[model samples]
Target chain A: MDVAIKEFILAMVVLDAGKVQGGGCPVFHAENSQEQQKTSLYLARILDGVVHDLENGVLLICRH
Target chain B: MEKYLIAVIAGTVSGFVDRWLMLRSDYRYYPTYPHAYLTHLALGFIAAGLGAVAIPALAKPDYVAVTFLVLAAQQFRDIRNMERETLSNLEKTKLIPRGTDYIEGIARVFEARNYLVILTALLNSAVVYSLGWQYVFLSAPLCFLLSLRLMAGSHIGDIAKIEAGQLHFDGSILKVNDVVIKNVGLPAEREKILREGMGVIIKPIDDNARLTLDAPGQRMAIIHDAVSILGSKVDVGEPHFAPLARKQIDQGYLALFMLANEPDLEYLMEIIKRVPVLESTRGTTLSSLYGRKAAD
Candidate 1:
């Protein structure tokens, strides 16, 4: 049987480094909104997850 | 011997024809392959033969042969298990899987159809044996009509009203009417969704209908059926574009959102209306005393 993680945050992309603190999932800091969006999109595709905006300058990639 | 031969032939032929009529390869594309058709038809023939022999076996007072009918029933039960396994395995590869409830419903239908086939054959044979071979024409059609009536369950249209819902992004959140469908982070993806997405609101006619639509499995079935017909923009990595059905907790209505390949809102609503209300998800809350009292 194939098994995979689901409904869990796989990674995070944030515009401001101070917005998100350290957590179990990897957090990527970007210079601006464009970079943050690009990083989140790439992370989402790579992790087979969806990008959800916390709307606090932080975007998280989660599998569901 | 001649009388029994006539009875069996009449019964088997009618029953096999009934099975063929019921096996439809529609937009769902199930049982599409010729091999699948062969499997079902072959099993149907066996069911028909068993049913056909039953009356004659009884006429001869051959209690031993009649016992084999019990074995045939056991074999039919295996068909349900076989169908469930095949469908569940297929579910893994589907972009929008037919939920377990839908799979169970389909599997149960397959098993039940065999039983219906047996009844048709038995009835036809009984008519031929008692009445006359000439009465085969009348009995066959009558049995077919009865089976057809029993086969049809219910459609979504019967329980709800489907209308086009407004699709818009509330900031990064996708909303179908007032229902929040999903949260998308990408600006480009959100734009694509706005351009291609379709939304429909399903208003349940009554409390029972509301409870039926409340089932997650039933919602999954609606999405699966709609996507199968309309085609979805969702791919392996693009989970955001996947079709979703969410209920409005306050009013008990459902809102569906999909970024479809065919973005025609009218056809999407039509497809949703035509979706079969799954047997397992049907709710009968109003039938109970407490539920009826609470509805007031």
Candidate 2:
């Protein structure tokens, strides 16, 4: 990941963490826009990978 | 002979009234079993036969009175049993999953309530038979009216359940138990995300049906977790957020990464919307153009 993307991802991590700590609720409605729908699909796909990697200890996050 | 005719008239009239009340009432489900409806008619005929057989056999009206009183007591007990069954059903349905099963519960309750109404009619028949013909005629209509009131109360309870999102249409189909459910997600935590990943889970409030979407990569893993959260036999599928286009693959990856961090459905939707347009024109053209247009 690029420095910028990593930083952006890091910001999101912090934001999500705040929500969890604050007892924030999850969203349920379907996406309205095509772009958003695509991004959502992509994000779902990636997390899908991370979950797999974490399962097998293949994640490169520590090395990175 | 005349007394028997009177008893039969009273019982038959009350039975008809009870049936009409149940059919016309707005109770979501009938509490009475269909067999109870048949029982009402049978009771009417039997009451008439008993009146004929017993009234002449005993010269004193007091003996006939005792007979009616005993019958009324028996019928009342049956009514109570019916009411207990209805309440039990309500309790059982409260535990039933809201959705399709909920509707089924409503139907079951409705049937039970209708049965109670029939029991009331039977009691009224006994009371009317005990009274002489003139009084029997009067009692029958009054019993029917009371049955209506009982139904009205049950309907009110039904409406309350419908309003609490505890009841609604399952789809295009309008059904009693089909309830609209909103599943709110808890924002992900850092450690939790590391363990569970970013994803949204949808679960039916009452049943073992659930859908979990982990942010893109190993979505299957999230599905596995959902299998346990929702239990067995739930059909799991992926969330169709976007198309797998070739050009925006990197943007897709970025969106997936962001989703892993946030995993909030609304936020994910907003970010995902920006992905394609952001990817287009080197990720800045449309917003810049709009910004310039606003400035100009």
Candidate 3:
């Protein structure tokens, strides 16, 4: 639950729960489409987390 | 003889009339498949029949049949359980889940409905047999409409004032009106809300309203309705652009933010106004305890 990061690592890979697929460095699994959209914005924009989609429900979220 | 027959007819008619008029396919729909309908309908008929026949059975100088009414009560409770189970199963598969409180409320209504059916039937039968069959034309519709009126409960609009709010960001924090929704530190996400974001601020009229709207599950339901009605503009990967209900619990106010396909403020406000008060999240201390204090 504590998603806090410290002494930032260059890149780390995390599995998405919602199964949204993309090229983002760290993809998140959102409960539904609306949630997926919010997660995309938060991780990709604010957190500077890369957000991309793959045909697989997996979305990739990573740090830029 | 013929009087008893008419009593039975009136009772059964009254019960079915309740079912027919009140049964609807809407946002909080009960499964309307033929199987579901037929099952409830059949149970309703038997309940009506039991109520109608109670007079005759008692007239026959047999009191033991009164026990049947108790059995019928038991049966009705089972119907509530059955309803809750089915809806709970269906919730698992839904894109926007109706929360547990909402589901339980629907289930309770389903169960309570059968008892209403029985009450209507019994009252009509008693009137027909005791007064005369002629009274049924007047009594049946009265009972049916009464049941319908009884079924209505609280709506969001009843307790809150809803107005469209502007979506703005200070730095990266998103604000719907004065309420800070979340710290959206992302520039792209902030831009999306400011450009495409539409929102509503719901201010509770009193403490009761505050208590009812405070539940996270209830707020989620409101957000779900807004999104389902307005349609989220963003697609699969856009988590930040999704509809959200951000609440100020102490202040008894909540704000909705969304990047909707059609950004109609009035329409979205109307949709939020109609969301039903969830069953499980039923009562509030505000109406009684807090209400008196606030008035004074």
Candidate 4:
């Protein structure tokens, strides 16, 4: 799916095993580009992190 | 006269046999035509000629001739550098580039094979010079066979168990065997992976095997070689659909997921079986020896 660049990743939350562990790796957190959400999603997948949309601007990644 | 004559013939034959075994294009159809084949063969002949004279020269009172072998080593180093540069340049033009580690491995193999030719020829010459023509006739074949054996390195099959695995979605999670590959939220992507993906589980036989498979570069080599042989169904742009190896870190097992052009499980497995175990990635529990008593 094609995600527009305008939205940008608002923030990333790391889940250790399933629990929210606060702000995740900054490398995956896009400061002002929604285009980075796609990248964050891909990196999360590589790490085998369970990703979820916690809210409108935040992404949650659960690493097992 | 017969001794030196036997050295020339047997040494040349031994070098040719070594080159014949090594100058292969099985992994990557490199050096594809008459030009490349002619070049390697000519170089092989030269290497043989150099080695054929070793015994005759060394046996003479002047030992200065041995210095040429040392010089030959410097030339082989250049050969390796050339191979590495050529492959690196060629890699940029390809869609799925062979990573630097694999490129380095191939370059090293080419350099070492030349030395193997030298060793085979020199040994054959020595045997003929010491014994006689009859001994070299037998010894040459024996030496050729030894070179063949030495040249054959270990493959993934030698150290790991590779088996076909099933891909299934647990809720929104995509998994191969028991390993969680990713969390697929899109049903379309899930369907695409399930319908097209070939899943394989590689179980390392020991701690050493686990460590070898653990490296990202080693896994990339496996994926590149397998996809190159089978033809990748996806392209460089499709990062989401690209072949990937996900490690089950707790147990140190690796699961490979790929959607290749062929999608033939048997073909994929056969190619994976033959992937050379990367020597640079080899690791063992004994590297640290923290758990063992010193005396043992």
Recovered fraction of real interface contacts per model: 0.69, 0.00, 0.03, 0.00
Mind giving the per-residue lDDT tens digits that candidate 1 earns over B78-173? 989999999999998998999999999999999999999999999999999989899999999999988989999898999999999999988988
Estimate, for each residue in B109-188, the C-alpha lDDT of model 4 and write its tens digit: 87787888888888888887887767877877777788778778899988899999999988767789998876554445
> Which candidate number maximizes lDDT?
1
Superposed by TM-score, candidate 2 places the C-alpha of residue B236 at a distance from the truth, in angstroms, of 12
Q: Which residue pairs of candidate 4 clash?
A: A8-A33, A8-A34, B233-B261
Which segments of candidate 1 are over 4 A away from where they belong? A1-4
Docking class of 4: incorrect
lDDT of 3 at B57: 63
DockQ of each: 0.75, 0.04, 0.07, 0.08
**Could you give candidate 3's per-residue lDDT for residues B144-202 as a string of tens digits?**
88988999888898888998897887655678888877655334556667887887899
> Which lDDT value does model 4 have at B78?
74
For model 3, the chain A TM-score is 0.45
Give stretches of model 4 more than 4 Å off: A1-64, B1-5, B183-185, B291-296
Docking class for model 3 is: incorrect
TM-score for chain B of each model, two decimals: 0.98, 0.31, 0.89, 0.90
The complex in candidate 3 yields a DockQ of 0.07
Alpha-carbon deviation at B16 in model 3, angstroms:
0.8
| Per-model TM values vs. the true structure | 0.97, 0.30, 0.78, 0.78
Which order, best to worst by lDDT?
A: 1, 4, 3, 2
For candidate 3, chain B by itself scores a TM value of 0.89
lDDT of 2: 0.33
Best by TM-score: 1
